[model samples]
Target chain A: MRLRLTPRDTSFFDLLADSASHLVVGANLLSELLGADRAGRKAIAKKLADVEHAADEATHSIMRRLNSTFVTPFDRDDISGLASALDDCMDFMEEAGDLIVLYKLDELPARVSDQIQVLQRCAELTADAMPHLRSMGDLTDYWVEVNSLENQADKIHRKLLAQMFDEIADPIQLMKLKEVVETLELAADAFETVANMVETIALKES
Target chain B: MRLRLTPRDTSFFDLLADSASHLVVGANLLSELLGADRAGRKAIAKKLADVEHAADEATHSIMRRLNSTFVTPFDRDDISGLASALDDCMDFMEEAGDLIVLYKLDELPARVSDQIQVLQRCAELTADAMPHLRSMGDLTDYWVEVNSLENQADKIHRKLLAQMFDEIADPIQLMKLKEVVETLELAADAFETVANMVETIALKES
Candidate 1:
């Protein structure tokens, strides 16, 4: 039997869910930046930055709450892990967009867009799953789906790498694209890490 | 003023300290691989892998102990953070070395060696600081110095990126070198993260 305590503030899950929503916005901005005209690139990146800042604020709230609240909704470690992973996903999205702006790449490869699509799905899935934590409901599907998306992203990433080396002839451009792709890959990896954390918590709770 | 309980296992610190020491060995092998001739590259990478496997074993031991022990030497979060960061450092080092062998580069630029040297210093400093974690004695300098080293690495990293764009001609070669340099940069970043974790623990304990 498990001892249950009513959380003074259920707002923790709300904040985390809000952060995940921010990631969706950031992911969309990134995907849009890839296909958008050159003139609109900076605007997209700035919007992505705004989303990242909001996520940062949300993460700080979680941390502050974790420190102040004697009785949390779940383990402090799990809360912190989820918050940090969400923040990292946002950070990597912002980074990939920033690299595009910084490098002034006229166009990103099509597969890059595919990876961003995976990120958007992961973000949405995470947001949907956050509220369920209050009940410690079944999250196996959430994590399993996220992991599947990550594997798709990884496949796209590998193909992109091979294409970059096999076909791209200019060293400077290859270097620039490499950074963007790698950042995207890191975001995908961070999302999977978040899923893994959720799975760990679910196993411990259920 | 604070209540303390004697931990069932003091060996957790010993395991973590051992992992940090393994990082030093891994860093050295990485550095040696850069300077060594092609004939010896495989040997160096294999040695680095051995060190990584040893670090992995130590990290697993720490995790097992955390699961079993009720009263840990410090917060389980801090212990896990330190161990994960240490493991990440080793992963990045091995990655950088493997990229070298996979790329089959005849020679690496001098600044990469400079970055590896910084890694060596960071590894040594982390190994030195892990034991002091038991006492929660003055760790201000450890983190501060590690942060300083990271700054130096960032400088070297930026210079290398600029130099790569300015000097390197082959796109495929540039991609390979960039991966190695970025991995090394990540290793430095991981070290800073470990330092930051140490500082967090010290503040909480003190």
Candidate 2:
């Protein structure tokens, strides 16, 4: 057997970590936009656009690296899945924020606060865990925490949906709130996917 | 530079094609579920579950192959992504069907028929494209058609959403219909993701 000497470019991990960090920024902004007034929310949304753009650039960097590199530190599929899932989380965050601004939703259900908080926790944990991907050590806790947070978010989602359908009178307002909440729920789901990807990689490597 | 002699396992393509075919099955059943009455829809949803289970098995086969194979016909990312995206399509399809049954929705918007038609077209195109993936010939048109179908589905989704929020008076009923439509929209989005993945692979390989 011929000995292979191609060096694994580890920069991809850094880029992924950078992308996860951007998710934290976007998720926090989403939480802030939930309570902001019209003008404030618009400004926050603009800031969110910047965050999403940064995450996009990070994702593009990852794709470029994947295309050029011959050998990766881990399977390319895991890397691609992680990058895309992180990008998705940011996209949903941006969508939720933009919906609030576009729909002019002045008031939201009370449980939205709890849901956003769960998202913020998921983001922070994602950012924290990404760096450890290089070592593939002590990462189970990250995914477990994210999974727990996602479950918490799901409970909030179900309760909020039930309350909206049962209590709201105006269909238009109900639809608007539902869209906003559902987007957040999707973002949470995406974060869970990312966590699952991380778990898969860790299991394979360990 | 040293030449390598390990044979690339190509069965991944077959498994992915199998998964895509299952998506076609699930999507067709979804179209049927929309037109189905109370008892008939439950039966259809059960059938969708079986399709989803088959797709899940196909996905697991891909994962097992990825774990054991040293060399793949294409980038492992594309293989795994294609499999997962196809699985997601079935999942969302199943979710939409189950929502219809669980929510006991008697009637959906007329525009939903158009959405289901677009999904059927996408499914057929995806199934046709999977066989060509091995040769990487004449696949561009497949992704192109899937993209066009997705765009058509988007238009229908927007119209349905607008109608739901504008016309529906009962919040509970509106809520059920919205969930059903949103799940179908998500399945359509998953199809677009699959198309994009195929395009990515085609661009890289050819």
Candidate 3:
């Protein structure tokens, strides 16, 4: 490891970690929403919205700190990029949940749970990985695993699309489910984007 | 304008301008596809796919140059970011065209054409703005107009969605048209992202 002559502000890492933690909460709420009744889904989506708001605040704080500080732990743009990417993950997840509620969709396909499960795994992995940014150690596995998970999510998404097209006769219902599924896929993609950003940062720092 | 002592490599501007020019072609092809019948759409979509491939090549060229060159006219990351954003515009437009063919959508909403018109305008504005990067003159109008165009696209998108839900009784047809419309909107948003990145670069430069 290279040594630093001057101390860098470390709160950025904490703020990032905080931002990612909200994703975990949001993802879990999405999972819960999948299992809930309509009323239950509404409550869970509300909670997810609250978590999304908190995540937004976390991102804004990071941005505020980034602008105020001359020296950063890494490139200013990367910090903002990572932060924006994390916020995207939450926004997609929250949007998925809201669509589930708004469409009043009853009986989503079984594979949708599979989609949420992938998101949960991604969120957990991402949240676990954020604190490691300081040392930039043990991050290869984190990004590699997230990349692999995203592949799994993609396969699930394609299969789910095919299944929906095959089984659902109702187009409106299909539209609603497809939107939710696509939004979830976007969330998974966002997670991969974060992983990719982290990989870029790690390579640059190394 | 700030004066620089060191000579900067200028080919980046040319490559970027070339990239944006492809967007004009792609967007126009999209407009043609909307007007075409099934056979014509397939032919046009094939052509659009070719354009998308060409755009991809342009983007890759930018990346290759970025990697090989030491001195760039602007921040290396900003150049890459702008290139990627431009590529996204083509991807979404190409996807919209492909879906139009794949789903065999016959009668699209009038507002769908409105969406493409907005994309056409954004593409023209973006293509026009890219050459100005060398001088960094008259770019504020470009980004500002693109931003306003994106807002118009969003409004059209929401109205189209509501209209499709209210008017289309065939669920499958609704699904196909809605996907196409949303993808076009994504193309519009990608243009805005490019504009936003340009704005950021211009600010930093100024």
Top-lDDT candidate index? 3
Q: What is the TM-score of chain B alone in each candidate?
A: 0.95, 0.95, 0.96
What digit string (tens of lDDT, one per residue) describes model 2 on residues B1-206? 88768877868778888888988888889889888899999999999999889889999999998988888999887788788888888898899889989999888889988888888888888888888888889976786688678757866876787677667878788878978887888889989899878866865675
Better of 1 and 3 by TM-score: 3
* Root-mean-square deviation of Cα positions for candidate 1 versus the true structure, in angstroms: 6.1
Better of 1 and 2 by DockQ: 1
Per-prediction TM-score:
0.68, 0.66, 0.70
Name the runs in model 1 displaced over 4 angstroms: A1-9, A37-61, A137-179, B1-15, B18-121, B136-159, B192-206
Off by over 4 Å in 3: A1-5, A14-71, A75-81, A94-106, A110-132, A135-167, A192-206, B1-6, B39-70, B109-111, B137-172, B196-206
Clashes of 1: 0
DockQ comparisons of all candidates to the true complex = 0.20, 0.17, 0.17
Error (Å) of candidate 3 at residue B13 is 1.6
Q: Ten-residue segment with the worst summed lDDT in candidate 3 chain A? A: A197-206
* lDDT (Cα, 0-100) at A133 in candidate 2: 96
lDDT per residue for candidate 2 within A1-206, as digits (tens), equals 88768878888889999999999899899888988899999999999989998997898679768867778899776787789899989988897888787777888888988888999999999999999999999898999999998999999999999999999977778779988999999999999999999999999999
Interface RMSD of each: 4.1, 4.3, 3.5
Please rank every candidate by lDDT, starting with the best: 3, 2, 1
Error of 2 at B184 (Å): 3.1
